[model samples]
Structures are given as structure tokens and as C-alpha cells.
Target: MAEGICCEFLKGLQKIKIAEELISLGKIACDIIIISLISQFKSIISMLFLGHLGDIELAGGSLSAGVANITGYSIVKGLAMGMEPICSQAYGAQELTVFRKIYKKTLRLVLVACFLISLLWLNIEPVFLLLGQNQAIISVAKVYITYSIPELIAQAYLNPLRIFMRTQNITKPLTISVTCAMIFHFPISYILAVYFNLGVRGVALASACNTVITILGSLTHLYLSRTAVRPWDRQAIDMRLEDWKPLLSLMVPSVFSVCLEWWWYEIMILLCGQLSDPQASVSAMGILMQTTALLYVFPFSLNQGLSTLVGQALGAEQPARAQRTAIMGIGVATVCGLLCFAFTIVVKNVWGKLYTGELEVLALTSAALPIVGICELGNSPQTASCGILTGSARPRIGACINFVSFYLVGLPVAVFMAFRLDMGFLGFWYGLAAAQASCACMMICIVVWTDWNHQAERARGLTQTTEEQASLLS
Candidate 1:
């Protein structure tokens, strides 16, 4: 009877542990989702104000934004991600000095990159002219991008700071900062765009202003919060050549992984313009892409949350807990995917109405929405597994897997089915579904087969200082 009671108690304890983890994951994910939504809403507000100026303003602004995303923002975001594993692990291991060093190093690297990107932005007109763009549109794009350089500089600070705070599970400050910025974004944008009559240039400057506000707010909170306090080590601040090697090693592959995936979507949009009915096909594709992005928010949030939890667990030398977190994260991703699938199906007939009134676009969207739903079943798990890989400091592996799945397998299938076999636009989505399925399967296998104990050892090696390791050994 005593033994039976002990077993029951152990089972109950396990149940409680699982519940606690779920709650923690949910809280982190929710905060991240809120931040993402607010950011997206800010973009919408900018677009709306630009649209009010005229279609030319809207088209030019939109074109500039796309170019900025492809060239500047994506690369900066990926580079910032390189610090995730190090920061998460350092915080987990309670190596506050290491964490601070990584943050400073990443911020410097990103700022340098922003400088190069600004040069490119300044000379973008010749490139756009070479691509056969309209002279008027290119002229407007030049103005918009030129004024947007400050925003890139702001991102250099914001991106690294966000990753640093996130790894430490300090998200509330970020949320509050973004919220305050958003509240001011509209009025500031209006004053500049309309009150000052600066057109798109004013709008771009307003965006820069918004980011500055967010940065100031976040920094203010960090300064006041005792939990986030980390005094900079004078020696660590003076980084040597070797100090940058580890970060670059992780940063390069991460850039490739993120850029490869992002470029694929842009390529798809370009391909749609080549279709027989270019207007309708491109319109439908745009609607579908927007739908996909909206569905992605939750899975992406889960990805970030899981990355932190797994890195923290491994850093703390709890291999078993890290493994458990990986499993539970995948399970949660599956449920989220199912819900996304259901949402697409239920809204299929009516969803396109939100974006457009054309019957042809609506019909195409209705048919393709289910395919997108199917894709989510795989995308959710793939995204979650990426987080696990990131936490384990094995992003190179994920990059390789993404290249094979998206470019090698998915792209050819899309071209062949869409053109060779006459599948049209639907064929494009079918190809995406295939890629997501293959990517998910491969990533899930990798996560399940990971040796958590080995990863913990790696975390120790990564997070500990030379002195700390040597002392521990002695």
C-alpha cells in the first residue's frame, strides 16, 4: 500500500510539472504574439496613411518597403538571431558577463551591417532602372528608401536588445515599449505625412521616430529593473578578433536560412506575375500569402518561446527537462496547426471577401485556402523544431535542411506542376505543401533523435568563461 501511494504521488508530480511548463510556454508565446501583432498593425497604419496620399504614393511606398525587407531587414533580423543560443544559454547558466558580451558584440555587428545596407539603399535607383521599373515609381522609391536609413540604424539597436531580453524571459518591457510607440505612431505619422506635406518621406521618418521611441522605452525599463541588471565587464567590452569568430560562425548560416526562406516567397510572387492571368493570379497569391503570414504568428511565437526554454534548460544542465520541453513544444505546435487548418476550412468561402471583391480572385482563394491549411500542418511543426535546433546551437543543420526542402525539392515541383503540367496557381501551393511536409518530418526526426546530454555539455562549453571551466575542472 505504501509503494502504491508513492507511485501515485510520482504520477501526480509529473502531471504538475507538465502543467507548469505549458503555462510558462503559453505566457511567453502570448507576449511575443502581442508584440508581433502590434508591429504589424503599425505597418498597416503607415500603409493606410500612404494610401490616402494617392495610388502612386501607395505603390511607391509599398515597393520601397518590399525592397527594404528583402535587402536590409531580413539580414539584420537573422544576424540578431545568432545571439539567441549564446544569450539564452548564458542566462540559463547564470553567466551574466557572457550574456552582456554577446549583446554588445551583436549590436556592433548589426550596426556595421546597417552601414553597408545604407550604402546600397542610396544607390538603389540604378539597380531598379536596370530591372525595367517605371521611372516615376523608381524616383519615389528612391526618396522613400533614402529617408528610411535611420530606421535601419534603429533596428541595429532594437534587434539585439530584443533577443537579449527575450532569452532572459524579460518580455513585458518590450511589450510595453512597443505598445507606447504604437500609440504615438499614428499621430506622429499623420503630422508628418499630412500636416507637413512631406509625402512618403515624412511617413518613412515617422517610422524611424516610432522605433526610436521603442528603443528609449525599452532602455529606460532595463535601467530601472533590478532583474535585468548586468554590469559590463571592461575587458569583455574590448572584444578581440577571436571574440567575434563564434558569433559570425552562427550568424552566417542563420542569415542563409532566413534569407533563403524569405526569398522563396518573393520569388513565388514574381512567378505569379508570369502566369496567364497575371492580375487575378497575382491578386490571389497576395491574398494567400497574407493569410499564411497571419496563420504563422502563433507558430512563430511558440518557436521563440521554445528556443528560450530549451536553451535555458540545457544551460542549467537539465538535459531531461530540455528533452521534455522539446516534446511538449512539438505537441503544442500540432494543436496550433490543427486549429489553423480548421480556421482556413471554415472561412474558405468568405475569407477572400475581406481582401477583395472580385469573383475570380475569391474562387481561386477558396480552392487554395485548404491547400494552405494542409501546409500549416507541416509548417507549424517545422517552425517549432527550428526553435529546438536554435536552442541547441545547431542552426547550421537547420539551414542545410531548409535548403534541401525548399529549393531542391519544393521549387522544382512548383515550376513543373504550375507550368509543365498545367496546374496553374494551385500547383504553386501544392509544391509549398510538399516542402512543408518534408521539412517538418526531417526537423521533427532531428529533434527527437537529439542527444540532450551532449547538448548540455556543449552549453557548458559555450557559456562558461575560461576561468570558470578551469576552476570547475580543478
Candidate 2:
């Protein structure tokens, strides 16, 4: 009878533990979404400002932003993600020194990368011309790209800093920092773009200023916050070429994985530019993309939070816990996706008016948004699986799957539907929906078949190496 009572107590304790974990995940996911939404709104504000200027500014801004995102921002962000597993696992192992070293090195690498990307941006005009973009919009795009330089530089620092804090489960500071920056974003953008009549350049500058504010705010918070981890060491900030091997191993695959997905979206925008009534098509897509960005924040937050959770779980030698976290992330993502679908459908016909009063653009956006909403259905689970891959330190698998799905399967369907079938801009979205569904299906299978214990062991090895390396360096 006493043994039976003890078992009952144990079961109750287990239930409480599960409840606690669910609550913790919910809190982290909420914090991350709040911060992400604020950050995304900065860009949306820019788009809104530019869209109000005219279709030329809207098309040009969207095109330029798409190019910048695909060629520069996505790459930098992907490389920074290489630090996710490292920092999360190191924090889990309580190896602050290793975490600091990886963070510092990643910052340096991305700075150099940003420099190279800026060079490309500097001479982006000729490249756009070569791509056969509308010449009128191309010239406008040049001005927008030029002003975006400072933001690019700021992002190089901001991405790593954000990841560093995220790994340590310190999210409220990021939320506060981004919120402060977001508060400044709209007023600053309004002054420069509308009040001063600076046009797209003003919008770009406002975005840069907002990013700078976010970076500074985050840094200040990190310095003041007394987390379990100690302050970052000044001595640990140097770049070590030997360390590049491990980071690059992850970074290269990560770059391809993220870039492949982002680049496909950009390519879709470019394809829209090639359609009849190019300006209207591009503007409609720009508005739709902005709307989609809002829905994306939740799933992306899950990706970040779950990646850290799974990484930490694996680092702590809890394979089952890591697997459970991945499953929970997918479940949460699915629910978010369904909710977004309903919201998107409800707002599709009206949201375009928020960007522009152009009847054609609004009509096109209304029709296209529902399709984008359909894509979201697949996007949530696919993105969740991506987070699992990141945490498992198997980014190559994600990269390979992305290439096969987007390049091999998705792109052809988009081209065929848009051009051959003469579905025009709508065809591109249909292809996008198909691609997302296929990618999600593939990723779900992989996650289910993943060897959780092996993933945990891999995380163990990664953290263990840092210990040995620190001993040697010391």
C-alpha cells in the first residue's frame, strides 16, 4: 500500500513537470513573437511609407529589398544561426567562455561578410539592369539600396547578440529593446518620409536608425541584466582562424538552408516583375509579402525558441526531452498556422488598402493573399522542422531538402504555371503553395525518423570539445 502511494505521488510530480515545461515554452514563444513582430514592423512601416509614395517607389523598394534580403541579409542571418547550436549547448553545459568565444568570432565574421555584401549593394544598379528589371524602378531601387548600408552593418552585430541572449533564455530584454526601437520606428519614418518628403531614401534611413537603436538597446540591457552567465570577457573577443572550421561547417550548410528558402521568395517577386502590368504585380506582391511577414513571426519565434530548447535539452543529455520539445513545437506551430490562415482570409480583402489605395493593386493583393495564407499552412510545420534540424546540428539535411523541394520541384512549377499556363502572378503563388506543402511533408518525415539519442550525443560532443579547447587555450 505504501509503494502504491509512492507511485501515485511520482505520477503527480511527472504531471506537474510536464505542465511546467509547457508553461515555460509558452512564455518563451510569446516573448520571442512579440520581439519579432516589432522588428518586422519596422520593415512593414518602410513598405507602407514607400507604397504611399507611388507604385514606382513601392515596386522599386520591394525589388531592392528583395535583392538585399536574398543576397546580403539572409546570408548574414544564416551565418549567425551557426552560433545557435554552439551558444545554446555551451550555455546548457555552463561553459560561458566557449559561448563568449563563439559569439565574438561570429560577430567578426559577419562584419567582414557585411563589407562584401555592401560592395555588392554599392554596384547593384548595373546588376538590376542586367536582370532586365524595369529601368524606371531600377534607378529608384539604387537609391533605396544605398541608404540601407547602415542597417546592414547594424544587423551584423545585432543578429549575433540576439542569438546569444536567446540561447541563455533571456528574451524579455530583446522584447523591450525591439519595442523601444519600434516605438521610434514609425515616428522617425513619418518625419523623414512624409513630413520632409524624402521618399524611399527616407524610409531606408529610418529603418537603419531603428536597427541602430535596437542594437544599442539590446547591448545596454545585456550589460545590465544579471543572468546566470557572467559578463562577456573583453579578452575573448578576438578572431581565431582555427575556430572557423567548426563554425563554417555549420555556417555553410546554414547559409544554403536559409538562403535557399529566402532566395526562392525573392525570385518569386522578381518573376512577378516580369509579368504584364509589372508595377501593379510587384506592388501587390510587396503588400502581400508584408502581410505574410506578420503571420510568420509566430512560427519563426517557435523556430528560435524550440531550437534553443532542443539544443539545451540535448546538451543536458536528455534525448527524450529534446524529441518531446520538437513535437510540442510542431504542435504549437500548426495551431498558429491555422489561426493565421483564418486571420489572413478575414483580412485579405481589406489589408491591401492599408498599403495603398490603388484599386488594381488592392484587388490583386486580395486575391493573392488567400493563396499566401494557404502557404502558411505548410510553412509552420516546415519551419518547425528546420528548428529541430538546427538543434540537432544537421543543417545539411535541411539544406539538401530545401534545394530538392524549392529548386528541383517548386521553381519549375512556378515558371510553368506563371508563364506557360499564363496564370500570371497568381501562378507564382500557386507554385509557392505547392512548394511549401511538399517541403513541410518532407521535413515532417525526417523529424519523425530522426535518431534523438544520436542528436543528443552530437550535442554532447560539441560542448565537450569546447571544454578541451578552452583548456588548451588557457
Candidate 3:
């Protein structure tokens, strides 16, 4: 009888732990969505501002932004991707020294990359050539992006800053950070874009201003952290090429994984530019991409939160707990997918007015959005799986999965359907749906296959030489 009673108590304790985990994931999901939407809402409005200037303005802005983003991802984020996992582990291990050094090096690298990219964009002529723009459109996009430079500098450093805090399960700061930045961004964008007749350039400047504000806010918060690994820990890092092994290993895969995935979307925009009546499809797609990004934002937030949580759990040597956390996060993400799916079904056409005056583009984008929504349902799960892998510190596995799923299968199938099949943009989007569904299945399979508990045990004992982990890693 005593043994039976003890078993009942143990079961009840497990039930409570599961409930607590579910609650935490739900809160993190909501927090991520709110902050992501607020910041992205600024860009969505910028797309509208450019769209009003004429489709050329919209297309130019979208095109340049896409190019710049992909380029930045490849160089900056890719190099910095190793920071999150290492930081997550250090943060969990309570090793302030390694955490501080890694970030100091990363932030320096990020700032340098930002300066170089800003110089490249401001020069304007080469950018125009690279984008294949005629003189007039190039001049406009140059103004827009040049004004947006400070923001990119600020944005470029964001991964390291956010990832550092994320390692400790700190998520509230991003919401506050974006909120403060927008306070400066929107009003300035309004003043420059509308009040001063600065046109696209004004919108660009406002975005830069937002970045400055965000970086300042984030830095201030870091200054206040209990961890001494805050922004000022420069002395902790050796700052030599030889000392970079720990950070670089993790960052390389991270940068590739996200860049490759987002590049596929940007390429879709470039391809639309080649279509006959390029204005209709490109404008429609630009609007649809902005609209769909709002939905994607929620998933991104959940993914980031999960990545941090999983990393910490693994750091703490609790594999089963990490599994439980990942499962709960995915479940919450699915519920979000259902709501987004409903929104697409119900409000598909409502947002097009925010972008274009053309009735035809508006109608076309509405039809395409529902399709994008379908893909998003699958995207949410796949993204969470990505977080699970990252948290497991297995970015290469995620990287391999992304390469096969997106490049090998997703893009090829999408291109075939979009042009060869003559489905136009709709075919492209439908192909994405098929690809996302397949990828989600693969990710789910990977999650089950990975031995998280064993990984947690290994991750706990950071005694292995960096070369040793490299050998074991995929």
C-alpha cells in the first residue's frame, strides 16, 4: 500500500512538471510573436510606402532589401552562428569567462561587417549594376537603402546580442528592445517619408534611426544583467584568430541554415521580376511576402525561444527534459499555425490595400496568401524542429536537412511548377507548400532519432578538445 501511494505521488509530480513546461512554452510563443510583429510591422509599412510611390519603388526596395539581407546573412550571421550554442552551453554551465570572450569577438566582427556593407550600399553605382536596375530605379533604391544604413549596422549585431541573452532563458528584453526602437522609427519615417517629402529615403532613414535606438536599448539592458559576461567583457576574449575555434564551429552552420532557407524566398522575388507583366506578379508577391512574414514572425519567435530553452536544458544535462520542452514548444506552434491558417482563410484580401492601388494586384495577392498560409502551417513545425536541433547543438544536422529539403527538393520543385508548368506565382507558392510539408516530416523524424539525453551528457562535459567535438559532429 505504501509503495502504491509513492508511485501515485511520483506520477502526479511528473504531471505537474509537464504542465509547467507547457505554460512556459505558451508564454514564450506569445512573447516572441508580439515583439516580432511590432518590429516587422515597421517593414510592412515601409513596403506600403514604397508601393504607393509606384510599383518600381516597391520592387526596387524589395529587391535591394532582399539582396542586402541575403548578403548579410551569408557573411555576418553565418560567421556568428556559432555564438548561440556555445553561449547557451556556457550560460547553462555558468562559465562566465567563455561566454564573455565569445561575444566580444563576435560583436567586433559584426560591427566590421556592418561598416563594410554600409560602404558598399552607399556607393550606389555597383549596387545598381548588381541589381540590374535602370538609372531611375537605382537612384531611388540607393536613396532608400543608404538612409537605412545605421539600422543595418544595428541589425547586423543583433544575433550575438540576442543569442547571448537567450542562452540564459531571457526573452522579455527583445520585446522591450523592438518597442523602443519603433518609437523612434515610425515617427521619423513619417516625418521624412510624408511630412518632409523625403520619399523613400526618409523611410530608409527612419529605419536606421530605429536600429540605433534598438541597439542602445539592448546594450543598456545587457549592462544591467546579473552575469558579468555583459557587453563590457572584452578582456575575457583573446581576440586572436587562434582562439576562435569554439565560436566559429557553432556559428558557421547557424549562418548557413538560416541564410539558405531565407534565400529561397528572396530568389522567388527575383524570378517574379522576370515574368511578363513583371509589375503585377512582383508587386503582388512583394505584398504577399510582407503579409506572410507577419505569420512567419510568430514561428521565428517560437523557434528562437525553443533554441534557447533546449540549449539550456542540454547544458544542464537533462535530455528527457529537453525532449519534453521541444515537444511542448512544437505543440504550441501548431496551435499558432491553426490561427494563422484561419486568418488566411478569412482575411486574405484585407491587407493588400496597405501596399498597392491596383485592383488586379490586390486580388491576385489575396489568392496567393491563402496558399502561403497553407505552407506556413507546415513551416511552423519545421522551424520548431530547427530550434530543437540548434538547441541540441546539432546545427549541421539542421543544415543538412535544410539543404536537402529546400535546395535539393523545395526550390527545384517550386521552379518547375512556377514557370515550366505555367502556374506563375501560384505554382511557386504551391510548390513551397509541398516542400514545407515534406521538410516538416523529415524534421519530426530527426527530432525522434536524435539522442538528446546522451547529447546533454556530452555537452555538460566541455572538457573535450574543440577538435574532438568537431570529429563527433555531423
Q: After superposition, how far is residue 363 of candidate 3 from its true place, in Å?
A: 4.5
Please report the TM-score between candidate 2 and the true structure.
0.88
Top candidate (lDDT): 1
Model 3 CA deviation exceeding 4 Å by range: 45-60, 73-75, 122-124, 190-201, 225-229, 239-242, 274-277, 349-359, 461-474
Candidate number that wins on lDDT, 1 or 3: 1
Tens digits of per-residue lDDT, candidate 2, 1-474, equal 999999999899877866766776777789998887777777778888998999999989988987898888999999999888878877877767877888888888899999999999999988898777888999899999999998899889889998888888888878888898899999999898889989888899999889889888878877776664533677744345555666767888999998998888778877887898899998898778777777888888788888888888887888888887888788888888898888889998789888899999988988888898899999999998899889777788889989988988889999999999999989988888888899999998999998898776677667656444333222
User: Could you give the candidate ranking by TM-score, starting with the highest?
Assistant: 1, 3, 2
In the range 1-474, model 3's lDDT, one tens digit per residue, is 999999999999989988987776666667777777887777777777788778878767876676677765356766666677767766776766767776787888778878887788778678578777787777777776776676677667776777776676566776788887777776787788889988888777777777677777777877887743575643655555546665566677777887888888878878887776688988898777777777788888788778877777777777888888888878877888888888888877687887678987987888888888898899988888888888777787888888888888888888898789888778778878887888888988888787886787656654234555554453
For candidate 2, the per-residue lDDT at 60 reads 95
Candidate 2: 10-residue stretch with minimal lDDT: 465-474
Candidate 3, clashing residue pairs? Answer: 78-255, 81-251, 82-250, 82-251
Off by over 4 Å in 2: 1-11, 48-60, 133-140, 190-202, 228-231, 236-241, 274-280, 348-367, 466-474
Better model by lDDT: candidate 1 vs candidate 2: 1
What's the residue-level lDDT of 138 in candidate 3?
A: 77
Each prediction's TM-score versus the true structure: 0.96, 0.88, 0.89
Off by over 4 Å in 1: 230-238, 465-474
